[model samples]
Target: MQFKWNYEPPTPERQKAAKELGEKIGMSPILANLLIQRGIKTESAAKRFFRPMLNELIDPFLMNDMDVAVDRLNDAMGRKERIMIYGDYDVDGCTAVALVYKFLQQFYSNIEYYIPDRYDEGYGVSRKGIDYAKETGVKLIIILDCGIKAIDEIAYAKSLDIDFIICDHHVPDEEMPPAVAILNPKRPDSTYPFHHLSGCGVGFKFMQAFAKNNGIPFARLIPLLDLCAVSIASDIVPVTGENRTLAFHGLKQLNQSPSVGLKAIIDICGLTNRELTMSDIVFKIGPRINASGRMQNGKEAVELLVEKDFRRALVEAGMINEYNEQRKDVDKQMTEEANSIVEKLESQKHLSSIVLYDENWKKGVIGIVASRLTEIYFRPTIVLTMSDGMATGSARSVAGFDIYDAIKSCRDLLENFGGHTYAAGLSLKAENIKEFICRFQAYVNNHIMPEQTQPILDIEEVIDFKDITKKMQADLKKFAPHGPCNPKPLFCTRNVYDYGTSKVVGRHQEHIKLELVDSRSSNVMNGIAFGQSAAARYIKSKRSFDIVYTIEENAYKRGEVQLQIEDIMPDTQKKNEK
Candidate 1:
């Protein structure tokens, strides 16, 4: 349970530049330095960063094949062809399906949505789904969130006379699918301005192009931003560029006037009284939506999402909430069992990656288990379970590691695999599990940086207690909808001592609620250190310590700031070292 504090003090030249820029922009140098690190050097860029406007979003047509995708959709609608909306079962996929289905359903009635059963059909463009489309006389399918690697499946659908328009954001293989038009910013030939977008984000852009082509007012598209924001947050995509604008406005929509389905979920989560943030979606909202997919069928999630009646949506949300409870129970059990297995590994300390296989493990929850193992072990980890006589599983990676590539390196052993840099899904013959593990582990060991296998707290800046002002707090608040690339800034305060009122809090006394002061000022800052009560004795000894933390609004006291301390260590230790 140790963390490496990562902070490099600004050089004098950079400090001078930051100060000059701060003066030019009428802001603090620390805030300016943070902006500069994010590549916002000029005042206008900083202005745009803080207040990203909707009109500034990149033109949807700039994406490769966007015109073709739009034209195909227009042709389908004009001919009144039976259209089927399809997506994966996860939050991003469900949201994509819901966004496209809800938007198109307003003007068209010949459309239906499909979410393949995770257990029955597995992931991506399943053969069963294509057969269903064929059976139902559907002529076109708009598959979202997953389809980049579905070459064979798309061809199968094509043979069935069903054309496909794929809207995905995953890294694609060299050979593309035989869809009518594939819309992915990561495509090799893509000229899209932004490279990172969630699956739902891609679907939103497709709808945007469709709206523009049909002369539909842009205001009509605003309501769907809530789904886009949920997907962006849940999928952990970068919250910069076009994503920032979408998430920013999406959050406004979520807080001010959420869709009926989301409103039902909000009320169920007891968040109806407060403004929802990205964190709320990640921790509270997204999981509930995903639970339906994990515990049962994801169709329930899409049904709830696109439901028009509040009463019906509320009923659906209640069922989904029950599923979430079930998911939590299974996840806890699986994570504990996986940890025990890892603890028993003979080469636990020397191993660079983890590959655990248990046929009895639930396939739906292995992804969560893999994530937990990666966070705890600080290594690329894969958790596999038996599915359809194959060892199928989910892979999660440490920071700065590419898990998808690691799995791709063992593609010969894998029957199918696809994902992003940090997360992926793969399946291999049960007999190949042993070989896959050895190769995957060796690849990780050879490529992963030594420091990448350790937990690190990346401090954005070092600032004194006195520098935390109302204006600085407000400026930080403007950096909303924070995620992967544009994260909530983490600040380091060196040599700060606990005030007399600092004491253990929490039901089990596992946290420290702090009243702290620094040597430079008498300003006592309130902070909370979760799961750090082990440091309470030293803190009470009046010993100063360095703390790395992110500033957050005090939940109990609105408008007041609280330091959510991430890591704490004695001040005498070597600074900023692993």
Candidate 2:
């Protein structure tokens, strides 16, 4: 739990130039320093980070199968064929289904959606789902968020005379499934400029190509941003560049101006038709949308997201809220169990990765356990739910490791696997699970660093009391909507004081909220550190420590312009270290 600050001091000239340019641009010296550290020295490069435009988005046709996928969807509509928009059950998957279903609905009346049951059928495109596609007499199946790993299933659908167009963002196998059109940037033949589109982003581009071909104004489709942005945030994709543009516009689209379905969710969160921010969506709305699949069926989220009636939307939101509540309960228990297992395992000996499976673990929440373990262990973690002679669940990894590719390396043992770098889903036979873990360990051992085996908070710079300003906050907002690749700036200030004489907060008293001030200068700021109530003891003693926090517009007071703390490290930043 300890991190050493290896501050990479800026060259004197570089610091001088950054400070001078920051003054010219009305930016804080701290922000200018952080920008320079991010290699964003040029005005043009920096400007694009903040004010990204839809025009900057790459052409939809740049994708390898965009034209073919568009043509096939159009063909299905022209022929009046029954088409099923297939998708996964997560926020990304469900929203992709919603995005594609809505786009096709404008032209094709036969468009319906099918999402697999998380417990019974598990993640990705399911054979049962495909069978449903076949039984519905679906002439065409356009898969969103899934199908990249469905080599066998896609072939089976093809055998049934059902054509498929896959819009996915998961890493591909050496040999792809024989779908009619494969629209994943990771595909070898793909020319898409960016390879890291969220599943919904890929689905969005598929719709864009369809729009361009069918003479449909994609402008009409802009409303889908609320859907896409929620997915982008929940799925944890980088919000830099194109993704940022989507989320920026999408967050804007969500404020009081949401669709009837989203309005219901907003109301359920006790914010009645008010302006919403990324925080509102991520902390409040996105969790409710994701809870359905994590605890029950992810398709419920899609139903709520696309509903047009306020009454129905409320019903859906209420259902989601209830599910999210139960999900948190289950998640809390599973996280504790996973943490205990990790503690027991690590106490015996060190390992490059953490892999655990249990027959009794709930399939719906195994991914949650994996994510939690990764946060605690700060390494690659996989949690599997064993049932029916097979284990299924999720993998979450750290920065330097690619969990999907690591799983792919042991594909012989896995019946199927799919996902991106940091997150993935898979199913492996119970007997092969042991061998799979060994190989997975080897895979990670070769790629990871000795240092990365332990979690390290990479601090860019430590700011003094005189380093922050409102303009710095605005400058950092330019790189938004920051996510996976471009993250919100993490600033650290050493030896800070609180104005409100801090107190433990949150439902569990596991958090600390206070107004921080420089004891000498009277420069005041506010912060909240979740799960850091232990630090309150230090605050009570008037201890000045290195604190790492992201600037947040605290909505705790309904409408406060004060900054909130994200994470704190009382001992992380030392004077001699700086």
Candidate 3:
């Protein structure tokens, strides 16, 4: 894939401020510069960034309708009313349901949890779920990770004498759902200081409010942070401000004393001794948890999460792992089929978007397939499959593209759609699929710039090999629990040569293993570029090159830092100059 390297240049004033702050704090200027670039310009800001505390979380009551939600919950508990916790099927929703249901189970026994089947019930606030609540004599229903736009569904439930308290983080419509209480930070009337809480984060805030109102110490809720962290990471929310604080502490909990289900999963993945990071959850744990819902039932995931017995949790985790294996098989086959279709479409190669459809494609893996297609085609892509009588699928956008808005432009054809800017889900009449595709392509062609179709390597700074010292590596560790907003810093080094012993490694010989030496100081560093064996030709040519990479402690060798290469290009300009 081709990439555009966009190097960030800190202004002179900002550089001077960072240097002064570094001197005041007795740290490296480069570390200070990185902090300032992330909006931490003062000693106080830097301290908070480095040491995020649980107390720093915003007051839960500050969220709009939080008080009402707490009051409804208190009433339910006092009356011993039957209440159902309803949630979506993804990781965020499953975790949210688990966290709230477990926390409430301590003080109440009339509660039950419900997760709508992805294929049968589709997305949020399903008619089947509402009917279940109504038939079971449930008086209150708490919706998590969804229901923000469930106006009609909420009204239908209300007619059946079932009140609702909604906890969600997705963008809301102009007219809010007529629920008893709606808690969302993105609501226009919200007074909450943070606006980027995941669906599980919103659910966590509600739990906090319930605990505080009942005179329970906030420490009692600390154990639930592991679930919150998993949700935040899997949901792909920005890791800044409150999220960073939550993830920072949550990871500590996950490493030190994970819940029974999480520990079982860790054992299954053979990560018992390793310290867990956000990346681990995103790849290993998150997918396994989500697989249960995708392949069979989300209730299995919730059951595993709230299970208190280690042996029982292990059994559940094993079943979920098998589901994950099934998910992987389906995902791989779907991706291969999608690739074959893309390859045969020679005429559609030059278009600004990719929209492919198949009646036999598994609806569960279309989202994952859409994401993988972007890596090969590198554009706004959508993968559609026949679900029910309609065409349903997922859309994945390249960086900086608003795929949700693009889908909204063709809403005339779509029966329903909802999601964030980078990703979304939609469905349309099966017959309208052709028209929707043409309109979607036209929308992309008109609005998407030519450069937006290509991938981008955002380099934070250009640095010398000598500057990558032990102290620098230590300073960088403070920026842990990295994600969307506060990402691991990427640095570019120009005019570097392969240190003669470099070669392609990995079982398939698809990884580049090299020792890079600086042109000026001749300082040497080991680098690994995973799946970049294509660059072997450039390395074998022995040409000076520029490489972009992030620094990481090499686990194979203690007390050593290595470069995890992001991109590499031959330094043709420098070669010409020589």
Candidate 4:
């Protein structure tokens, strides 16, 4: 896929500030500029950004309804009331359920977790789940990740004498549910300092409040940051402010001493030796946890997460691994079919958005397919499939688009819908599929920016080979747990030529392994351009080309840094000069 390289050089004033800050901090100006771009203008802010502290976390009681939620929770445990920890079936939801259930189960005995079946109960607070709670004598249900929209279900649970304390992070409507307390940073009246916590993060805060109220040591909560890190990375939330602190510590916990379940998964993924990063969770561990929900029951994921026995957890992790493999197969097939359908669309090129429907498509993997389509076509996309006599599917948006609003615009046609700015889920009558498609596309057309329709590679900074030093790479490590708000820096280095050893090296010969040297320095840097073998001929011709990439430590050579090239283009500046 072609990309538009987006690099807005900092203004003179900002550059001066960055220079001054760099000199003050004894680092390169480029590193300081990246910090400034992320709104870290002062030394204190940069220090906090680099060295996130647990003590710096916001007071949990500062959140709206915290007092009520904590009081209700404490009362339930005080009376030994049977409490149910319920959650959605996604990663954020499963991790939230596991985290809460694990923590509370330590001190409270009358607690169990519930994950509604993706097929039988669908997403969020199902009537069946409420009935189960009623039958099981559950007096309080702490629903996580997805209760903000379950007004009717919460009422039903209430009628059965069950109270709800909801911990969610999704955008909420003005008319809130009838829960005993709702803890969501995105609530209309929320004054929580950080608004971007993951659903699990919200759950964590609830637990934090509970711990603080009970005078429990904060050290006990540190173990659960592994789950928070997973949810924060998997849910694709912004990693700034509170999130950064949680994820940074969570990653440390994961690498040093993970919970038994995550340790099992880490071993299964063959990543037990190396230090795990947020990227590892997003790519490896998160998928395995999510696969259980997609292919089977999400409860299995929670069960494994809260399991104490390593042997049992390993067996569960192995099963989850199989589920992940199955999910991948189904996801790949659905994505290919979706791509074929999109290719056949008569108005494919001109349309501002994409909505594809097929009754035969697997509902389990439609979200993955929709995400694949958005990445491939670079447009807001929704892939729907027939489920429970209704057309149900997931929607994915481009970098800056609010897909939730676009889906909300077609709510009349949709039987149910809820999600965030870049992703959502919806179901509608089969007959309304065509109208929903037209309406959703129209809304996107009316609101989407022209640039949002295209794939754009944001180049964070421009640097020469000389700037790619050991010190810079080490300092870059300070930017751990990168995500939405604080993304891994992307660098562009221009006019670099291959040093005679670039060659195709992938299993299908689809990648270029390069030994590169720029004119500014004689240092030969090792780089890998994945799936860019088509550019091998030009690169081999000794023609200088410009590249945009991220630097990472070479897995093969532990101490060496390698450029993971994103894109390579001919040297336009040098073309006229030569």
RMSD per candidate (Å) reads 1.4, 2.7, 1.7, 1.5
How well does model 3 score by local distance difference test?
0.91
Residue 286 CA displacement from its true place in model 2, Å:
2.4
lDDT of 4 by residue, 1-578 (tens): 88788999889998899999998877789999999989888888888888899998999999999999999988998898999999999999999999999898889899999999998889999999999999999999999999999999999888999999999998998799999999999988889989999999999999999999999998899999999999999999999889999999999999999999999999999997998999999999999999999999999999999999999999999999999999999998888888888898888788899999889987788999999999898999999989889999899999999999999988889788899999999999999998988888888888989998878889989999999999999999988879998888999999999999989998899999999999999999999999999899989989899999999999879879999999998865346546
lDDT of 2 by residue, 132-249 (tens): 8888889998888888878888888888899989988877878888999999988877788888788899888888777777787869779888888888888888776578888988
Candidate 3 differs from the real structure by a C-alpha RMSD in angstroms, to one decimal, of: 1.7
Model 3: residues with Cα > 4 Å off, grouped in runs: 573-578
Error of 3 at 548 (Å): 0.4
Worst ten in a row by lDDT for model 3: 569-578
lDDT of 1 by residue, 368-405 (tens): 99999998888899999999998899999988999989
Candidate lDDT values, in order: 0.93, 0.79, 0.91, 0.92
TM-score of each: 0.98, 0.92, 0.97, 0.98
Q: Can you list the residue pairs that collide in candidate 2?
A: 50-478, 238-484, 499-515, 527-565, 528-565
lDDT at position 370, candidate 4: 92
> 8-112 in candidate 3: lDDT tens per residue?
688898789888999977788888888888988889888988999998789999999999999999998899899999998999999999999989898899999
Q: For candidate 2, which ten residues in a row score worst on lDDT?
A: 558-567
Worst 10-residue stretch by lDDT in candidate 1? Answer: 569-578
